[model samples]
Target: MRERPPAAELDAVDRRIVDALQGGFPVCERPYAAAAESLGIAEEELLARLQSLLDRKVLTRFGPMFQIERMGGAFVLAALAVPEADWARVNDAVNAFPEVAHNYRRESDLNTPFNMWFVLATETREGIAEAVRKIEAATGLVVHPFPKLKEYFVEMKLAVRGEALS
Candidate 1:
């Protein structure tokens, strides 16, 4: 993979935007405008900063967080014991599915069987199994699924502030 250029340093406005948006984005017909109003900036400026952040790779993705189970869907944390040589190929093959929400490469202990971990979100419970099967078939590796047995916290948001905002 090509290395990404360093991200540009954020200014006060940019920091404020990130801080404000991270808490919870407005859900309205004019969400951006509402968000900008709360942040004491014009809608256009807020949008421009957001776009710039994305372009500079400061933010990889900007989207709503979903509760799959509440939406009649399911999600599972799965891992694969991928050989070092096949890392790139396996990563690509597993990520090819839309159901694969995110993937991470982690250092494994000597006794650990899996090295690559990922989350699979699907429209239905059965979809999770189907996605695992497809990934197994594509990568020729067993996907060990760790489904949630108990409910806990859903998500966490980090708060960032510029010197001025702070």
Candidate 2:
């Protein structure tokens, strides 16, 4: 993850785009057109601006988040305790799995064996087990699965400083 904020250079329009796009994206044949219409901008301009934002690293990811469980799929949070010497290899091995949604490196004050964490999304519940087994085999480390016991709904949105959503 980038340590620096890309917030310094965003203009009002870019800020609006970032704020507006956090939720309620259109689902239509011409979604961009619809979105651009709502933003009061040309579709082509919206495309160009979005591309520019990505190119400038202002947005690391811009995509839809599927409700895998609702779709009869499963999402499992998994972790691995990887040695410092094998970080690269293990990271590559874990990320190579098609089921991996995203991976992160973390640390704790306690002597925890797990430092590498990731989320796995699979079409079937059994697929989570298969993915964990495959990752363990590939990385020579145990993949700990932590399935969620409860779901919490949190809606997060932010506006640029000195600006408010109208």
User: lDDT values of the candidates?
Assistant: 0.85, 0.86
The list of candidate 2 runs beyond 4 A from truth reads 1-8, 61-63, 158-166
Could you tell me every candidate's TM-score relative to the true structure? 0.84, 0.83
lDDT of 2 by residue, 1-166 (tens): 3354435577778888888997788888998899989999999988998999899887767789778898888999988999999989999999999999989888887968899999999998888999999999999998899999997987677765655334
TM-score of 1: 0.84
lDDT, model 1, position 159 = 59
The TM-score of predicted model 2 comes to 0.83
Q: Residue 151, candidate 2: how far off, in angstroms?
A: 1.1
Model 2 deviation from native, Cα RMSD in Å: 3.5
Report the backbone clash tally of model 1: 0
**C-alpha positional error of residue 83 in candidate 1 after TM-score superposition, expressed in Å:** 1.0
lDDT of 1 at 41: 91
Q: Best-fitting candidate, measured by TM-score?
A: 1
Residue-by-residue lDDT tens digits, candidate 1, 73-104: 99999999999799889989998999999998
